[model samples]
Target chain A: MDRLKSRHLQIAMFLLPALLFYAVLLVYPVLRTFFLSLHEWNGFAGSKVEYVAFDNFKLVFEDEIFWKSLKNVMVVMLLSIAIQIPAGLFLALLLNGKWKGIRFFKAAFFMPVIMSATSISLLWKFILYPGDGLVDGLLMKMGLEDSIRAWLADPSINLYTVILICCWQGLGVVMIIFLSGLVSIPDAIKEAALIDGANRRQRLWFVTLPLIREAVAINVILLVIGTLKIFDNIYVLTDGGPNHATDVLGTFLYKEAFRNNRFGMASAIAVVMFLLGFVLTLVANRAMRRESLDG
Target chain B: MTNAKVLRSSFMLVILAILITLTACGGNKGNNSSSSASSPAASSASSEAASEAPKEKVTLRIASAYTPDHTFGPAIAQIIDEFTKQHPEVTVEKEFLPVAELDKKLTADRAANNLPEIFIIFPGAGTADYVKEKKIIDLSEYLNADPDWKDGFISGALDNLKFEGFPGIYAAPIGAYSTGFYYNKELFQQAGVEPPKTWDDLLAVIGKLNAAKITPMAIGASESWRSEHLFTALFYKWNGAEKAKGILSRALPYSSPEVIEPLNKMVQLVEAGAFSKNYIANNYAAEIADFNNGKAAMRYSGSWTVGESTGPNSPAGFGDKVGFFPFPYFADKEEHKDSWMGGVSDSFAVSSRAEGHQKDMAIELVKTLTSTASSKLITEMAHDLTAVKADVDPAKSGKLIAEVSKAMSTGKEFSGDISAFEPYKPANTKLYDLTQAVLLKGITPEKAAKQLDDEVAKSK
Candidate 1:
């Protein structure tokens, strides 16, 4: 009994630091945001904080900009999954072979993933700079001058431009994730598929993709969470501007809290974002799990 | 002993070690915090003693948005160096943050009652907020105590720091600037047009520039503040300074003809394509680049551009060919022609909590920072305009600087950025957004004006 008590005490002691850190860093902030969202605070230290329960959330829901930001985030999420996943999977398959210089190809493809988002956004901004930008110049040289549009300026198309850059930056990570999953699969499985008269496409569909369910699940969750929190790239590229044509929830929350000094309103946005991320992640994981089980 | 007993004893020893470590850390933290808490008071007391005994030390911390790479950085360093040389027993600790970050940090510090001894403050609305909260010390009494120092500041420069409803001057002017057009004479001549002197003249000039295939202006409407700057220029031109201030006091609604008319004229310029191609897509850097590279005829900006344009960094500087003109006035509003937009760029403020020797040191630092010699050095070194009167040598002050100095000096009255004059931060942000929308045709001028009025009313 004495030894059991000692063991339990030892376990508690071992867990205390990590638990304390989690509470202080993560739990405390989340709870504090929720508390703040229920009040009106201008984010100044000496300013009056009034208890205005649900008012901030009500305002957020009523805000057209908030709805616009949500729609933009959803577009990004949908496009990221549609574009990045297939492109990543294709690249993974292409580089999975033991061809010479495959490593170089893989590294080149993965380069953008390692670079900072701010740098990527800046680089792309330069490349897509209007009138004399690389894209316009290339189009003009190709006799496609009519195709050149204000890539980061036009409200109608700037969000899509941002989505394209995001897809480019995100492709490398998804490809690497799929590559790891592919490498871990038993070689015998592919050989068996081959012996069973499976074509390249058939083998990919029947043998390889089924085996990488976990990676797909991870990629989906990561892309969803990433798109929802996308700020730095959009912020750097356009600052959610040309009239906030690219504002995501992250940027909107930042503007509310820091720019407008409405911490309560920003906290309400954050809470909504958190709940949305949590629900979407759960739904994605569950759907992925169900498919895996069916397979 | 048994194995279980030995294990238990070892576990107990590990727990004892951890407890001892935690307690030591806690004790050290307590001592550090307590010492830090008392250090300022102790230093002030020591400085008071040092006046009598002559060997004690005083440390003063100043926070500012001026980084070492900024033009003002070297000027600030010189002032600090001069001050420290005069007072060997004093140390001035500098905390430099970017402007946006500094606003946040200052707000946080004010809440905690832990502001640095001195800090840079935005001249109008930002000063008003700090003054309203009584977080910053009023400088009126100190300025008045020394007649020479009070008179040293340029006429009307200090008034820019004075806010309505605030009883005292909350800040001392450090830098003064005004906004207007910075145009390339070569481009104007290429288009066979002179700098516009009135709204109708501006339209005629724009037509000629467009005919000559020159962008009449470069506006980075993607950055909403650019749109806000244009709005201010138009508003001040048509309505005059008094009516502009009336909007701030809510005596005039934003939706009133005085405000909406300017918004309409701005939209008309957008429709006329006065700005660069895809101007709404361009950022501030792109706008400046267009003007600098001679791709555009004019760039609407502030006096701060003089340093960069004349500096070695400029690839194709116009040198003496650069000319500045205030935004064209309304042809009919000749009475309000002298009303220009722009005033104090930034100011230095002392903390209200600062007392005794610390307060004395802070005030002395401000005086040193804005002294005639220091202001002249800043003017020559940085091509900056200071709030204090400085005799700028035209040979050292480039053509653009000299011209801007003349324009600012001759201006009868200055109203600051209209958006910046709003004490409520959210309304200020909304005004910028509405201006951007209006410029982009996302909303009509009438709608934008109504929205601005609604936002201000709601914020109030």
Candidate 2:
């Protein structure tokens, strides 16, 4: 009993330092944000935190811009799940083979993943500048001048353009993850499928895909989290404007906290975002688990 | 063992560990402060505290958005460096952030109560909010005691730096900017249009430019300030000084025709293809590029761009092609024809948190930063009007500054930026966002007015 108690103390000693940092950094902030959300404070300390219970949440509920931002976030999430996952998987499959120049191709594909989102977004902004930008310039060169439109200016389609850019930037990370998962699957499984008279397509469909189901799930989760947390690129590209048409939850909260000086409303939005990410990830994990069990 | 026994033991151990860490750190703090072998800052502080020290040394941590490349930063730095040279005991540390990121950074700093003693202050809602929270120390007392300092400022220059609904100088201003239209003379000449003599004449010029297939005006609505500058120009032009002030003070409704009429004119400009195809995508830089590259005929920006347009920064002959025009009014009916929107571009202030030596050091920094020599450096190097008098030479400061100086001197009315409207920043943000929505959402002038009115009502 003395030895067991000593070991338990040793365990506590090992864990305490890390736990202290975690509690101070993460847990403290989460609790503080919840506390701040309940009061009307303009981000200044000790300066009149008017205790307007649930007023911030109520304000967000009535705000048209907030609803619009929520809708935009939903659209981005849907697009990432449906488009990014498949595109990444397809690229991963194509690049998994030991081709003569596969290394060069992989390097090219993963380059954007290493580049900063802000720099990439700014680069793309100039490339898509309406009259003289590369996109419009190429169209004019090909005598498709009629096809030229203000890609980033049209509010109806600007969100989709930014989403496409995001997918382009993020696809490499998903591809690299899927590639690792593909490589991890035993070669014997593919050989066995071939020996059983399965065609190449059939072998891929039956063996390669099922073996990397975990990769698909992980990629989807990452894509979802990234989509929800999307701010830097969209902010650089459009800043939730030509009038809040491209607004997402992150930028919306940013505007509230910094621009409007409404820290309470921003915290409320942040809490809502956390809840969203929690619920969605939980649902996704459950669905993936149940599906894997069935398969 | 039972789970309860294990949990209790672990909790006890955790508390024990925390106590040890705290006691250890607390002991280190005392040791670190008392010894001369720690951080440079601590050593300086120790030296300052010494009673027999002949001179004291201190450092001021400044947070500024004035990057070295920006027009103001180098001149300001030169001024400060000169001060440091004269007063060898003082040290300055500056952190430069771009203007876009500065506000959010400063907001975080404010919340943490860690704002530097002397930092750049933008005289708008940010300054007002800081003043309201009592975070900024009133400089009036200091200024009053020093008549040379108080009298050195340009006539009425410090007026807008005061807090709304009070009589206190909240900021010490550095440079002033004037807002007006900058037209490409070559394009205007190509389109056979002179500077518009009336509101109708301006519309005719837009039509002519559209017909010529040259983008008539460049606007960067993505940055909402461009739209507000448009609003300021048109509103003040259409309805002279009194009505404009009335609208700003909320004595007259924002939905009043005097305001809505100018908004309608903006919509007309948009419908006439007065702006480039992707004007909404272009930010200030892109807008400037389009105008400089001769793709756009006209651009609205502050007079500070005089340096960039004329200097080696831009292509040669760019300066000669550019000319300024105050926003046009109804020639036959308008009063206050010389009125225009202009204000102090940047200001500085001392923090309320400053204590003892820090307070004196902060005041001294502000005085040195805005002294006549610094003001002269600002005018000659930055090509913007100084808040204090500076002997600007025509050969050095160039023709654009000379022209702007003449225009400013003749102008009878000058108002602050759109930020001066609505004390609460969120209301100002709403106004900017609604202006964007109106232009992009296909909302009519009346509908836009209604939305703006609703926002103002909610703001109350």
Candidate 3:
């Protein structure tokens, strides 16, 4: 019993520092945020704060702009999931093959992921400038002047432009992850499929894809979370402008808490965002688990 | 094995205790001076003489919402340098931020009670709120002791600096700005039209410019605030001061016909091809570029644009051609053409939480920066209109600045923008959105007014 107590004490001592840091930084703020969400405070003015439990959440639910922001987030998430996965998989397959200058190709594909998001967003903003921007200039040179339009200004297209930028920046990470997973697949499996007269597409679909399901799942989950919390790109790009056309939960929370000084409302929005993210990830995990079980 | 485990556990516990003690000691060291100096009465008394202490060095942190190289930042820096040179015991450290990030930083700072000794404040109704909350130190005592300092500012500029229902000054004005229509002189000449003196004439010029294949007005509606300014300018002329004041003060519903009329007129102008194609997508900076590059004939902006338009790196062929016109009013009998949209000042207030010599140094710096000599230097450097009446060279004043000054001086009542007077956050953002929606065609003027009513109701 004395030995066991000493062992437990050693483990506790080892864990103490990390636990203390977490309590001070993360756990405390989260509890404070939960408390803040229940009261109305301008965040600055020492105004009388009334506790209206759950009212802020009700207001958020009823706000049309909040719903629009959620919809915009969903559209961005779907686009990233739909386009990034298959494109990343294809690139991963190509990079995994024995080819000349494969190292150069890998570096080139991974370049965007290494660039800062602010720089990338600003670069895209410059490229999409209406008349003299690179995209417009190139289109005009190609006798496509009629096609030139303000890419970031148009409400119909601004969200899509941001999504395209996001996918472009994120493609490198997804590709690298899939490439590692493909490399880990037993060469014997591919060879066996090939020996059975499987073509390129057949071998990829039957052997490589099934084997890399774990990587695919990881990639999807990461992309989903990343897309949901996307702030910098949207903030730098459109600022949720042209009539709040590009607002997302992150930007909305930022505006409310910082710009509007409604800390309670902002915290409520944050709580909702956290809940949504947690619930969606759980649902996705459950679905994936069921798929694995069935397979 | 048990003995070894016991020894390891004892050693680990010792290390943990050491770490906790070190952290505690470090925290105590950090707080020792601050907590002692933080009592309001103590700081208030010490603020005056803290600079005289030769042995104690006090560093004052100033937060500014201007880029370091911008006119405002450098002006403050120059003043701080002069102050520190005289009083070597006091040092000022500045943290420069872009305008977009200022409110966010300020909000976080306020919550943490870590606001800078001196920070920028908007002299709107929100100043009243800050005063009520006692977040900012009252400047009445400081200003009253130095009566000559009051003479340095432009007349009536201090009106906005007064807190609601309070008899004393709560903040100090750093500079002033006014909004008007800036037209390209060359473009106006090329189009064979004079500057429009009335709303009808302006519309006629728009029609002519459209026929000539020129985008009459270049605007950035995407930023929302810039677009909102145009609506405010129109509202000022359309509804007159009394009605506008009533609507802005929430004494009248935004959906009242008085408020909706001007919005509808703005919509009509939109339908009549008054603005550039794809104007809804343009940002304020981009729109300025369009006007400067001769792609668009005119832009509605504040005097701040003068610097960018006439600066050394100004776009090709923009020099000597920019001209100003007070935003025109419709010739209808009811409209007040003499009324203009103008504000007294943009200011900085010392935070109440600042202690020791920091508060004193901050107030001194603000006073020095706003002195006539410094204001002249900054105005000339920034190519901005000077709020204080000074002997600026007519040639140096730039025709646009001269014209705006003339307009403001001659105008009947220089009423503030309703949006400018609103409190920070929800009210201000709602106004910004309403203006943007009008410009973006997301809502008609009637609907825009309705949206304002909805926002007001929700806010209340």
Off by over 4 Å in 2: A1-3, A101-104, A114-116, A126-150, A180-196, A206-211, A293-295, B1-7, B15-53, B244-249, B331-333, B440-442, B457-460
Q: Score the docking of each candidate (DockQ).
A: 0.41, 0.48, 0.46
Consecutive 10-residue window with the lowest summed lDDT within model 1 chain A: A16-25
**DockQ value of candidate 1:** 0.41
Better of 2 and 3 by DockQ: 2
> What is the C-alpha lDDT profile of model 3 across A130-211, one tens digit per residue?
7778998999899987777768888778889989999999999999999999999887887889889999889888788888
Give me the displacement of residue B53 in model 1, in angstroms. Answer: 5.4
Would you list the rank order by TM-score, best first?
A: 3, 2, 1
Model 3 docking grade: acceptable
**Number of the predicted model whose TM-score against the real structure is largest:** 3
Q: Write the per-residue lDDT of candidate 1 for residues B294-347, one digit (tens) a residue.
A: 888888888877876775556655556778988788878887788888877778
| Range of the 10 consecutive residues with the lowest summed lDDT in candidate 1 chain B | B32-41
lDDT of each: 0.82, 0.79, 0.77
Tens digit of lDDT per residue, candidate 1, span A78-172? 99999999999999989999999998999999999999999999999889987678998999999998788889888899899999999999899
Per-residue lDDT of model 3, residues B82-151, tens digit only: 8889878777777778765776677787766577878878776755766776678778788878877777
Chain A vs. true chain A, TM-score per model, equals 0.92, 0.92, 0.93
